[model samples]
Each structure stands twice: as structure tokens, then as C-alpha cells.
Target: MQLTDDRLIRADTDTVWRAILDPEVLKACIPGCENLTGSPEAGYEAVVAQKIGPVSARFAGVVSLSDLRPGEGLTLSGEGKGGAAGFAKGSAQVSFAAEGDATRLTYTVDANVGGKIAQLGSRLIDSFAKKLADQFFERFQAAVEGPGEAAEEELAEVDGDATAEKKGWFKRLVGG
Candidate 1:
């Protein structure tokens, strides 16, 4: 399957680029993400719970960023396994253009699936992938431009606030 789209974010290219690479920002934006970890040299590892029509599964994957040109473009590639559900692998070339204080991000993705997911029909898979990508970009735009520079500082300050909050609640229940 193939998917493509572009969005304009009301932020500088540098800011947009930083948010795109920030693990916390991505985790907050990605739908059903259970975990996301980034490596300076090795890209990122993600665990995502996805539901397509009547099927639901957890997918673990590694996404690598390559051919990077700061504030310009890069290629994102990843493969995920969903056990009995299926497997998916794809690559997307993402390009950014400066538009005054805003940035325009354009992306084109080519993906392939095998197993149960492959058998589910192309229309379903295409629609699902489009929806997922749309949701990701929407959340990402909100995170980057919502609260101005203060939000950016806050994002940096509390990298794993979500996980920490969960841990805190668990500790309270255990009377730690």
C-alpha cells in the first residue's frame, strides 16, 4: 500500500524538526503507543497497540531515520511484528520546507504487509494506514504549536511524564 500527505505547522523548521525527533513528543502523538525509546545512533524502538476493524494486536518495531538533512528531509523506515496478526514494513521519505515561521512537511510512504493483515483486504489496510498517519501528524502539530515556547521547555523538562505519573500512582497504591 502507498500513502502520502503534507501538513503545514505554525512553527520554525528547527522547532518542528526537534519535536519530530523527540521521543516523548512522538509517544504522546502516536496512537496506542505503549512504549517508545530513541537512540542517538540507532533510531527508535516502539510498541504500539493497533486495532483494525475487528482485529486488535500489539506491534513491536524499530524505526530508523536516515539520509538526514537538518531542517530539510529524511527517510523513515521500520518493520513491525504482531505475532499471529501479521507483519508490516515500510519506508517514508519526509521533506520539510520553510514557510516564514511555519514549516511544511511532505511525506510519501510505501508499505507492505503479510499474514492475517495481508488477507484483510487492501481497502481496509489503506484506509487504516491513512487514518493512523493523519492522527499522528495532527497530534504532532498540536504538540509543537499549542503553548508556544513554554511548551517546548516543558516538553524538555518532563520527558517521561506520562510513565512517571503512572509509576507514581502505582507506588501510592502500594504505599511506597
Candidate 2:
């Protein structure tokens, strides 16, 4: 599946970039994510748990960042397996720009899945993906801007892919 989105962040691009690259910030924003270890140059390992449809499982995976342009953007890719549930792998290109005093973050994700997850229809998967993205971005924005600063107004242009892929993996682990 493919997904894209952009959101206006209240912080400056530099601040947003630094926050986005912070493992602690990411772990907090990702739903069901238990831990995230490593660095931008070395790569990261993650563990997450959730129930997708009727299946529940924990996924352990590795993510790498490449083609980095510093505070501008980079490519993020990773894959994970969930025993009998299934497996998922995908990548995303994320970029940032100055939007007045705020930052405009945009992302595009291209991903594929196999195992029982492939059996689920695209519509179901798409809706689930959207929900996951919305939740993650909402939380992420709040974290970056500070709690209570994440009013509905700032979420106006939000969009993109990584969170949905995480959601897909959760679904994949459960079954299609």
C-alpha cells in the first residue's frame, strides 16, 4: 500500500527535525511501541505490540535511515515478522520545509505485505492505515509542540506513511 501526507508543525524546522530524529520522542509517539534503540547513523531496532482485526502479536524490527539531507529529509525503511500473523516491509521518504515560523513535514510511503495479511481487502487495510497515521501524527505533533498545543487546528494538513506501515505490521501479525 502507498500513503502520503503533510502537516504544519508549530515548531521551527530545526526543532522539528531534531525531535523527529530523537528515538525517545518516536517511541512515545508510536502506538504500542515498547522500545526503540540505536541512532541515525547506526540504525534502530524496535519492538511493538497491538491487535489488528482479531489478531494480536508483538513485532521486532530494524529500521535504517538513508539519503539523509540533515534537517531537510531522509529515507526510512524497515521490516518485521510476527510469527504466524505474517510479515511486512516498507520504506518512506520524508521531507521538511519552513512554513512561516512553523515546519511543513511531508512524507510518502511505499510498502508491501505477505502472509495472512495479504488476504485482507485493501479497503479494510486502507481505513486502518488512515487511523494509525492520524493517531501517530496527532501524538507526535503534541509531543513536539508540547501537550495541549496540539489543537485540531494545527492538524489541518497532516498526511504520510510510516505509522500506517506500523499499523499494517500489527495487522499482518494477526492475519488477513
Candidate 3:
């Protein structure tokens, strides 16, 4: 299956790029994502729990970013195995650009599934994937912008007051 979409985030291009590359931000945004380890430069490992149709499983995967241009674009490829539930593998091409004070992020993704997930049929898988993508972007936007501009200030303060604590907790949880 393939999917494409774009989002207009209310933040500068640099801020949006940095946040998207941050594992902590992705962990918080992606539904059922248990953790994300590693970095953009070294590839990333992800553990995600998901339920599709009647099957539920935990997927462990590795993702790598290629064709990278800092604060610009990258192509991400990954594959995940979910024991008896089957497997999924996909790649996404993401591009970023500035739009006034905000950022425009455009993405194109191609993926395939096998086992029980594929057994559920194409329509279901397509809808589920679309829903998950929507949820991810929504949460990502919130994480980057916060609750209006006030929340951004609060985050900056938090980053200052508990810099080590915050980073440590995130690193510990993600095992990075």
C-alpha cells in the first residue's frame, strides 16, 4: 500500500525538523510506540504495539534515514516483525520547507504487509494506516507547537530547569 500527505505546522522549519528527528518527540507522538532508540545518524530501533482487525501484536523494527539533508528532507526505510501476527515493511520520503513562520512537511509512503495483517484485506489495512498516520501527525504537531504559544514558553522553561532530568528520563525510557 502507498499513502501520501502533508501538514502545516505552526513552527519554524528548524524547530519542526529538530522535533521530528528527536526520538523522544516521536515516542510521545506515535500511538502505541513503546520506545525509540538510536538517532538519525545511526539508524533507529522501534517497538510498537498495535491491533488491527482481530489481531494484536508488538512490532520491533529498525528504521534508517538516507538521502538526508539537514533541516530539509530524508527517506526512511524500515521493517517490523510481529511474531504470529505477521510483518510489515515500508519506506517514506519526507520533505520540509518554510511557509512564512511555519513549516510545511510533505511525505510519501509505500508499505507492504504479510500474514494476518494482509489477510484482513486491502481496504481495512488502508483505512487503518491512514488513521494511524493522521493520529501521528496530529500529536506531532501538538508536541512541536504545544498548547498555543504559552506552552512553548513553558517547554523552554522546563528545558532549562530540568534539562538533565528530562533528557535522562527520555534516554532511559528509550534505551538510547
Candidate 4:
């Protein structure tokens, strides 16, 4: 599968670049990521768990960044063997540019899978891949922008503070 998308991060180019290269930041951004260790120059090792359709796997892989251009961008490549579940490998070309006080990040990804997972057909696999990509990017954006940005935006669109709209835990549980 192939996918391309872009997001406007409400942070400076340099800050965004730093977050992209940070192992802790990357680990927090990737969904189901249990562990991520290593440096950009030497490549990183990762353990991620996920369930796609019916197949569940804990993938151990090596992720690497190449063609880096400081605060600009780089290519991210990785491959994971999921034992009998199958294997997945992919590469993403990522670019960054400053737009005013923010950074615009664009990524183009090409991914492939083989073995038992391939039997699931293209439609299911494609949708799962798209969801996974969206999840990673969304989480990354949130990490860079800091927590509560989305909640603040939502509150701004409403008439009152979001706290006033909240219900107690018991009320929500009983559909009160």
C-alpha cells in the first residue's frame, strides 16, 4: 500500500525536528509501541503490538532514518517479522517546512506485507494500513503540540468552558 499525507504542526521547525529524532517522543507517538531504543545514526529497535482484522502480532523490528537534512526531513524505513503471522516492511519519505510560526510535515509511505497476513486480501489490509498511519501521525502531532490542544480547541468552539459540560462518572455510566 501507498499513502501520502501532511499535517500542520503548531511548533517551530527546529522543535518539531528535535521531537522527530527523539526516541522517547517516537515511542510515545507510535500506537502499541512497547519499546523503542537506539540513536538516529545507528538505527532504532522497536517492539510494537497490534491486531489487524483477526491477526494479532507482537512485531520486533529495526527502524532507521536516512537522507537526513537537519530540520528539513528524512526517509524512515523499517521491517518487522511477526513469526507465523507474517512480516511487514515499509519506507516513508518525510519532509518538513516552516510555515509562519508552524511547521508543515508531509509524508509519503509505501508498505508491503507477506506470509499468512497476505491471505487477508487487499481491502482489509489497505484499511488497516491507513488506520495505522493516521494513528501514528495523529499521535505524533499531539506529542509535538503538547497535551490539551485538542480539548482547548473544542472548548473554544463551544459556548462555555468544557468543564461545565462534563458529567459525573456515575451520571455518564448510567446514561443520566
Task: Give each model's whole-structure lDDT.
Answer: 0.77, 0.71, 0.79, 0.82
User: Model 4, range 72-144, lDDT digits (tens) per residue?
Assistant: 9999888898889999888889999999988999999888988888899999988888888888888877777
Error of 3 at 135 (Å): 1.5
Cα lDDT over the full model 3: 0.79
lDDT of 2 by residue, 92-152 (tens): 7889999888889888877665677656767766666566666777777767764342323
CA lDDT, candidate 3, residue 63: 74
Off by over 4 Å in 4: 147-150, 153-176
Estimate, for each residue in 1-176, the C-alpha lDDT of model 3 and write its tens digit.
Answer: 78899988777777776776787887887778898899888988999899998889999999777898888988878789999999988777888999998889898888788998899999998888777777877787777654545554576687785233222232333332
Query: Per-residue CA lDDT of candidate 1, range 6-122, in tens?
Result: 988776787777766767776887778899898635889999898887778899998788898888988877788999999878888889999987899998988787888888899
Q: Indicate the residue-level lDDT of 54 in model 1.
A: 79
Provide TM-scores for the models.
0.79, 0.79, 0.80, 0.85
Best by TM-score: 4
Clashing pairs in 3: none
lDDT score of model 1?
Answer: 0.77
**Candidate 3 Cα RMSD (Å):** 6.3
Better of 1 and 4 by lDDT: 4
Backbone clash tally for model 1?
A: 0
